[model samples]
Target: MPTPNQAALDFLLNRRSRPAKTLTTPVPNRAELETILTAAARTPDHGKLEPWRFIVLEKPALNRLAALVDQRGNDLGIDPDKITKANAQFATADLVVAVISAPVDSPKVPQIEQVYSAGAVCLALVNAGLAAGWGANWLSGWASHDRAFVTEGLGLAEHEHVAGFIHLGTEKNAPPERPRPDLAAITTWVDA
Candidate 1:
């Protein structure tokens, strides 16, 4: 059997995401955040295309994003309830890293793999924060999918899209564990 890291395996088994609302101030500082980002960047890239990037949002920028979300939601005729929910997240955000999926031109590396890499980066960022004793959650809502919001609020390019918005902060309270999936039901075994 290959040598295993018990602590790492234990963390993986018990890892739970803290809800965004429960996340408070005291996010990762510059050097510390850089460590997390570095961990996140260690995702798989088939062709070294590195088809992803991170945009860290502070309080002021988050406030501006909230306003932009409000405006865009109204302009796009989204329901008031949905608009309110979307705007609220930005308004209350302490700090977030916007995971952007920017697929590059690659003859062998497929676009789908690039997208998956971006997603892995998001998950890695979340786990890094959690392991460092901070609350972290990955969230993406209607705002992420809105082209106008992505361009105007976040300044993302035409080829870029938000894979996830990873919010990191101090934990307000330890949340109870929710229901988990039944592994047997979701698993498939085949020996061909």
Candidate 2:
């Protein structure tokens, strides 16, 4: 019989990401954040490509990113409303970990596998924050897709992209549980 880890299972079943906008101050300190990053690095990496990295944005960096977003939005002729909302994300953020998808060139490891590894890193960071009793949310908006934004805001190279921006902070209020996927509809079992 397989041993059941009830506590871990319970935590997974009940885990819900807090809204980034609702997160407040008391963000994780450097030492605490290092622990979280260590946990995040434990994600699956096929062929050991390690195709992901993190950029932790503190107060000053977040402010600079917000300014860059505003400038990029103007340069791209985006709607003012959209720019406002996008800038707010960084302006109000207590701490954000930018998951950079740095896919390595490898004949054995396909690029798609590298992208999947980066995605796994994103989820690991989210789960690590939640397990550490912090409010966490993975978010990416229009700015994430803009080349100018990626380059100037995040300094991404041609081969790198932003997988996600994980916001972590204390929750002002616990968000109620949202709907969950139906297991029967989403899952399948096969015996061949």
Which 10-residue window in model 2 sums to the lowest lDDT?
147-156
Q: Among these predicted structures, which one has the highest TM-score?
A: 1
Error of 2 at 85 (Å): 1.2
The estimated TM-scores of all candidates read 0.98, 0.97
Instruction: Give the whole-model CA lDDT for all candidates, comma-separated.
Output: 0.94, 0.94
lDDT of 1 by residue, 59-114 (tens): 99999999998999999999999999988788998999999999999989989999
Q: Write the per-residue lDDT of candidate 2 for residues 1-192, one digit (tens) a residue.
A: 999999989999999999999998999999999999999999988888789999999989999999998999999999999999999999999899999999998999999998998888899999999999999999999999998888987889988999999999999999998999999999989998
Candidate 2 runs further than 4 Å off: none
Where model 1 places Cα greater than 4 Å from the true spot, the runs are: none
Whole-model lDDT, model 1: 0.94
